[model samples]
Target: MDGAEREVATLLEQLQGLTSNAEQVEGFRRVQEIVQHRDPSGAERRVLRGALPLLGQIVQLRNAALVTSILQLVAQEASSASSTVTTASAETLDVAAALSAGLYEVCHTVLLLSHSTEKNVVLALQLALGSLHSTFEVALRAETVENGLDTEPRRAWDAATRCLEAAAGIVAIVPEATGSDSNRSAMVWLRAWKFVESGVMLLSTAQDSSVYRDPARSNIQPNTWSLDRLSAGTQAILPKTKLEEFGVMLLKAMCEAVTSKSDNRLPLQRRELSVAVNSLSLLASLRPQHMPNILPKLTALSTVVATPGTEDPVVQKSLTANLVKLLSHPSAQVFADEVTDILIAVGASQRAFSAISKSKEQRRKYTSAPTEASLRRARIGKRTATQSITERVENANAHAKRRRVNLSESSATPIPAEKHWQLKKVRSECVILGSGETQDSKHRAKNNQHWCQFLMK
Candidate 1:
């Protein structure tokens, strides 16, 4: 086993040392064969651990195959952090360390350009970023690390911020990459924002209740991303520079979503935009300077969706009330005078102003009472084919499951066995003559249909 490790390491070095582009490509393929064909105990992890660094080697070569191999490896191997080398172990930083500027530049270039766009590349990039964010999320939330460093701003944290940048930068380019999946782009935005969101939540203890919150969020599970819920450190300071970069990227993403109206106008995509508005509002409250950058986009949010109300959050809070909750959040002090006129321009109702004075409970009072969140996701009057199939399967399983005796509907006492039918049955010699019932039957118990069975005759 030691010999095999040496052999793999030796092969990797030789692969990197090769100057000829053609031979290096061949050598790269050979390395994959050696690791995987040899049937190592953890072939995927080994291949990934060995291949991730290979990305830098091929960056100058411009070989999509090599880049794709590493990405596909990361996509497949990094999904389960428990088994992969990227897990939150002592060597956890290894994976983050390998996310070189070369890798980011390559991914960013491929993701941003339509002609260069590849689905495999996109999928792999999404998986890689999401996995890294989730992985470091634990360390950031830890009370203290093994290295005695602060929760964030360390090597691991620095790499995590890189992941946020990479993800958000891809989000900014999603509109231009005409062939890329809009859904995937939205997901990347969500992942990037969530990483930032957790960081802020951990640092901001005083403002938890003060922020404009979605009531539906109260019912959902908190985004811990860890098995044993590690809360954030209130005193942990976030890097102001990187935090501002996230706000900037979020604004870019929101702009792209609007510009690509044909692709992003659906309820789901619009819902994502609404969440971004709320998130920007949250960031602005913490840092007032973000308000100026975020306000125009919030006004552009005149196109809010109707569903997802009272779900994770009411989109822009107005989407929760279908245009009623677009109040002037305190973050909008810069444009306080224009908010009402803007809301009016966007077709917001009289309730938009009236609801401002309402209390938190009262703010949501005007929420569409009919649009209840079913199955914890608020969707109404809309069902895709997949959702229809899912609902059917769920309903079938629900019907097959046994009901509690206490909760089951009581039997109707046989509906009193209609007296007219009973009298007619008696005339036809088919009256029941059970011991508890009337024994005034016209026929013996054996002859009565009430006591009959499918006898063999």
Candidate 2:
């Protein structure tokens, strides 16, 4: 037999053995050697290229640990200098393709496992989904930037689109399992939604940057392309229509899970529901202009939050934050009364105040205190002692007012600008009202004064 034929035979035998024995580490090592061997024209190299399909099959087995290892190797190779060579390029592309296929398989497997009676498998699937989402993102981004294209690389974008499509499908699969039986799956879906949200945000950010808008910029950063170009390529795969469908489905599933009163699913459902609410909140915040599209989804979620006897502290907090932000949307006033009622019912106002107060304290503690010696050093000029006193008093009053405002929610009490200078002087010496009340309060007070003086001077 020819050398190439012999090498192919040997590699195939190793793959079969590895799979039969489930020797994941050994199998991965063998794949690595095949891809990395220096001999360009050698039989082993040719055989290795042919073995891509087999590697894909192994990933399809739903072994997340193995999939993770393979993905890491692929990412590492893709990032290396060797990946740019002509011969190495084909191998890199093949590896990327294989990994993408395997990722889809893994996602599918997770969907199936989500239905398992075993808790471990469900939890494992949730964790696996998270890892797979991140890996897919890295691979997708790498492929796009691999070679500077005037437009996004269609192949890479298509692959990413498929991955997200698969994820959406997985989320849809467990709609009926909404109560406890599917709580874990719901959490996985929530995370997957975040992955999609971030991807869109990145795309949007890229579109807004000069790199995408001006072709005259000689060195266009990789992945920077006109939104028009992106929209065209992504139209079929992640069109607005598809996004709306997915968004609606996600909202429905989360609401069902969260509102489920079944004893078995209550805890898990509540946890997943909290995550879903947070994810929705983030999406709303990042894409406020898309409120018309998002409002209905929020409405559905709000219904669950508003349900009597379902006032979970965590969920309430999440819902309140989302609603407060939603108030900024033009259509928010339509639901303002209901949203406000829920916020108050859940004590979100008090919670928000407490959070603000704590944040002020934290800011105060971490900031450096202005020493009297530093103040004295600043009085180098023939400025009158009264002038210094006036400045110090202004700094102290300003600092005190800020501490009060930050600690209190009332927006009506605006401290005079001159008072800030007085507050600054006393900020280092005496504790401002509400200052040093808590660790967070002290830090916050100190930070406020530090920034105020820094800016004023």
Model 1 agreement with the true structure over 1-457: per-residue lDDT tens digits: 4454557667767866767767766776766676555636452244445544545444434455555665554444444432343344434433433333224444444444444324544554654455554444534433244553342224444554455555555545432223354424555556545544444433222232233343223432222331224333332424444444554555555445433244235424544556655665554443334456655655545433322331223454543342233343443444644666655654554655664544224233212223345533545356688989999999887766644342344332232346545545644764446667644443464455542222111
Evaluated with TM-score, which candidate comes out highest? 1
Span of 10 residues, lowest total lDDT, candidate 1: 219-228
- Point out where model 2 deviates above 4 Å: 1-9, 17-24, 39-49, 61-68, 78-156, 172-191, 199-268, 329-334, 344-457
Alpha-carbon lDDT, every model: 0.46, 0.47
Model 1: CA > 4 A from native: 9-30, 33-52, 79-116, 141-143, 147-156, 166-174, 177-206, 210-293, 300-323, 328-337, 357-457
The Cα error of candidate 1 at residue 165, in Å, is 3.0
Model 1 global lDDT (CA atoms, 0 to 1): 0.46
Measured by lDDT, the strongest candidate is 2
Name every residue pair that clashes in candidate 1.
Answer: none
Model 1: residue 73 alpha-carbon error in angstroms: 1.3
